[model samples]
Target chain A: MTVQATLKAPGEKLIRIRLELEAHEVREAAISGDFFIHPEESVSILEEALLGRPGTQEKLLKRLQDTVELGGLELVGISAESIASCALKAYENRKGPGKA
Target chain B: MEEWRLIIDRPGRGTYNMAVDLSILNSLARQACPPTLRLYSWYPPAITIGYFQRLEEEVRINKCRAAGVDVIRRVTGGGAVFHDRELTYSVFIPLSHSLALPSIRESYGLLCSPIVECLKSYGLNAHFSPVNDVLTGGAKLSGSAQTRRNGVLLQHGTLLVGADTELMFSLLNVSKEKSVAAAEGSPEGRVTSLSALLGELVLDGEFQTDLSMRLANAFAEGLGCVFVQAELSEAERREALEIEEGLFKREEWNRDRSIRPAFGAAGD
Candidate 1:
């Protein structure tokens, strides 16, 4: 399962990212951002949260929200709506029509 | 009294060394081996990344590959470290042991006291830095990391006897040129060598041997035990091979440097 999003600022290029999940833990994640914000620490925190746990859309969103809030990171130009929508799409894709 | 097993292994590759350490930790967890102390070295200097460090940002992969340096990821967490011209030590303690120190900091302090004493015996003022580093004159000469699982703790570190600082800088991502300029401009502290500490005592291999013995003895005495020289059991060797095959060799564990891209990229 995977979730992806692109965040862009006015007059700036878009930054794309994809989060792939496996067995409830984050298997691999890739990010290409127009602005550098030290993505490694954030990604690690996400990985730690996903490890050996059940990966659900709500759980994943909560993990990211909690980490960003606690760390006091600036989401800046990132679209929160896009993130939630992408996560839901990925979750739905993984669960299929009957399951969702 | 509890018996401490000592293993002095010949020079091996980095993967083998990590395998042995993990194997020892596993064996201790299973109560198949007594608390053990291992002294070993790497044949080709290796760059080991901490469990959490981004491989790309932490190591210069091309430089290491060109120099025939093996890169491995450790089960412990810390910054990346280059292992060359240094003695590596791993100590495993089971939770059931009466003398087992609680918490990472306490265990580091307890185990490193002997190293401090040994360095002092050689006329070098070495001190243990909080959170696991040994420094001389406020510059790190050794750094350690620990991992606890299944009631067993594995603490390991490098003792820099002699190192190629130029090569180290080339292999690591350290901004040495900038740091040196910064230091010259402001006199900031930097890494120091064991030879610098030994000064006139350079030619004395006997002193090094004595220091090693003293550290082993201190650990044994501190824990109310006798040191027993031993080799790896068949089970340990088997388990080590299995772990190496499974976790250590996996790209997901070692090369998946993407866990934190915000920090840096993956090492090639």
Candidate 2:
């Protein structure tokens, strides 16, 4: 099932996350926002990196952090933690056969 | 005094305008051109969403099409902007320049100083707000966006001469409550135009020319540089055309924000 969550983290631009979750795993993910990220293409890379990752906060946050570090991405008004939190929020909001 | 190119462009289509800016940035990055300041307007009027924004979430495409308005995506990241009844200015500088500070907030403040000065000349008490906004009396009068790549910085912003809040709201994805508020005068009661502030219509060739000159002078004084009026070189024009065709005009780039050209993407 697909779920979406929007966040306006303090001192950051609005971030909207959409995730397709199945069995508590992220099957697909798309992130969009007004936040600034250097090497802007890294945004697409980060989105692509989310696929098949376990939709837990810790796993998602670790994956995002590793991706940012590996890519040397500079986020001006957003952060990996914020994005991971947003993705987790989407997962928590998911509606599916097994999900509450 | 240091010298810069001052390009006063005639109103052009959205794609062409964006193409010219990117072309200039690319040239400067390659050390093929001097620093530049370009002042321009939109032909059909347009909406430019920031790089990170999703078009489907930010703009009402069918509404814009019916109104003969163009929708383009900017290389810089920021909130979406409506380019109607506004003069847009862009400045390109190498990172080694004194004005291009290492800190993003500091750089924005320095680059926006000219805009604040220009508004102050018209008797408005304007000030630069952090991250890329110019404000007067707590209402936003101008907003800017920036991108740095290959040790070059390009910052562009808009100065509103007039506004059609209802039309703007129709083209953007905003709530009915905000649209109604905008109809009363300004968008969300937070935007004010030069015409509204000056208590007269500021739309005319003479006024535009005067405003452009004033902005150029302000930039020259603020940056400690002199500007020589010039047209885009043949090479730059050709590059702009290339970008217009290869990047700006492409559906994959504009609507989907995919398929970026090497020179068009932003990075440190």
Candidate 3:
């Protein structure tokens, strides 16, 4: 099933996420935010790396950290940690309309 | 140290403005142009999203069109900005230029120092708010973006003279809480303008009265670089037109991947 969520962390970037879960991990995902990232083209690259990762903050953080450490991406106005957290927030929000 | 070529331009549409900046950037990259500083305004106002931003997520299409606000993408990376009642400046210099510095973070502070000083010339205390914002009295007075490519760096920013909180907030998406704050007056509650800060300093509240000349002079003094007043060369104008037609005018180019996959894409 397709899932979606929106998040705005005060003093932080605003993110909107959509995903299709496959076997618990993400099958397809799109992450768009008001944040700025250098090399602007690496946005999709980072998103691609996030796909198929577990839909949890810890797992996503580890994955994001690794991808960033690879040295191809440089994010501004936001960070990998925030992205990971926002991704989890999106996932969790999608799971429960009443809870989030 | 070379004297910078300073060009003051009248208000223009978003596409043409971006095209000129990019053209200057390209020329600087090739060493075919001298280090330059441009001061310009936007006609009918406009919204320029960061280079990587997904336009639909950041802007309200109907609101932008209804208000006659032009929408275009910047060659630099930053958040969406409402370019109204603002003095927008762009600087193009080689990476090896003395002011270029060794790091992007350092360069932002280095480049924006001129803005801070310019605000100071107005007798307002402005300081560089790390990462890339200029602030005074704890309120943001300016914000900037940068792009480094082809051995050159381009930095551009806007200093608010008179901000229309309602129009800007209307064309942008914000969190519910922030939206409420904006409705109350002032988006984010942290942005202020020269007019607002200097309520009685000038007779004209718009702050556009001789604002451009004041900024140009302040910037020249602050950067310690002399400005040789110049107009766009024929080559620059031609290049800008080429870029305007080839990229900025194309809907597909401006709206790339801005929409959610399920909902598809739409535009101005």
Candidate 4:
């Protein structure tokens, strides 16, 4: 199932996440928004790093932080915590068998 | 005072404009060109979307094509902007320069000070809104975005001389009703043009040239630099053509946000 989430934190720009999930794992992810990230390519790197990860906020946050440190990315108006929160929201909002 | 090259460019298409800026940035990074301040305008007009923005979600392509407006993606990150009735300025400063601030947020404020100064000179009480915007009278008057490469930083911004709220809203994928509200200066609308603030419908070539001159003076004074009138070198022009072909003018690059540049990540 594919689910999406949009988040606009108080001091950050809007971030929209599209998560493709199967069996409680992230198959693919696409992140887009008006936020600024230096070297710009770090965005694609972030998305690629999310592939095959567990669809949980804590794990996603760790992965995102690792990617940021390894990539030396400077994110303005957005952060790893916000991104993970949005991604997890998408996973929880998935309207598949997990729904009540 | 430090000397910086100043180029007053005539109106140009969006692809050529973006290509020229990127080419100049590369030149500065290579230490092949002096720090430069370029003032320019768009000829047929265009909308430039931010680097991370989804093009289809932000723009109406068919409507733009029907209206003869060009759309391109900027390397800098910000909201999409409609380029018309505005004076655009780009400043390229190598990190070696004494004026280059060490942090991105501070650099935006430093680079944008001149715009606020110019607006203040016009008696508008304009101020710099951090993270890249200038506001006056509770509405935005100018917005800027930045990209760094190698050891150089490039910041470009637009100062609106007039506003075409109707046509701008039509081309953008935004609520139609906001256009009327914008013209009326409703609280929901946050854009204000020079003409609107000054209570004059000033859209003449002479006015543009005057505005450009005033801005150039303001930048020189604010940055503690002297402007030496100059033009792009032949080699730089050639590089711009290459960039136009390789990046800015490509349909795939314009439409797809994920298309990486062949030259690799900037600043790497």
Best candidate, TM-score-wise?
A: 4
lDDT by residue (B1-268, candidate 4, tens digit) is 8889999999999999999998888888767778999999998899999888888878899999999998999988877899998999999998878778878889999999999998887787999877788988778889999988777788999999888899998998753434455566642237889988776536554888888998999999999999999999887888888888889988889988545554323324
Better candidate by DockQ, 1 or 3: 3
lDDT for A63 (candidate 2) = 87
Model 2: residues with Cα > 4 Å off, grouped in runs = A53-59, A96-100, B175-189, B201-205, B264-268
Off by over 4 Å in 4: A53-55, A96-100, B175-189, B257-259, B262-268
Alpha-carbon DockQ of candidate 3: 0.53
Candidate lDDT scores, in order, read 0.65, 0.84, 0.75, 0.83
- Against the true structure, what is each candidate's TM-score? 0.68, 0.89, 0.86, 0.91
How are the candidates ranked when ordered by DockQ, highest leading? 3, 4, 2, 1
lDDT of 4 by residue, A4-74 (tens): 77776656777877888888777888888778888887788888877785556788899999999999998
Cα RMSD of predicted structure 2: 3.7
DockQ of each: 0.04, 0.45, 0.53, 0.50
Predict model 2's lDDT versus the native. Answer: 0.84
Which candidate comes out best when scored by DockQ? Answer: 3
For candidate 3, write residues B149-224 as lDDT tens digits.
6667888999887888987888986556456655665334368988798876644744564676677777677677
Residue B234's lDDT in candidate 1:
91
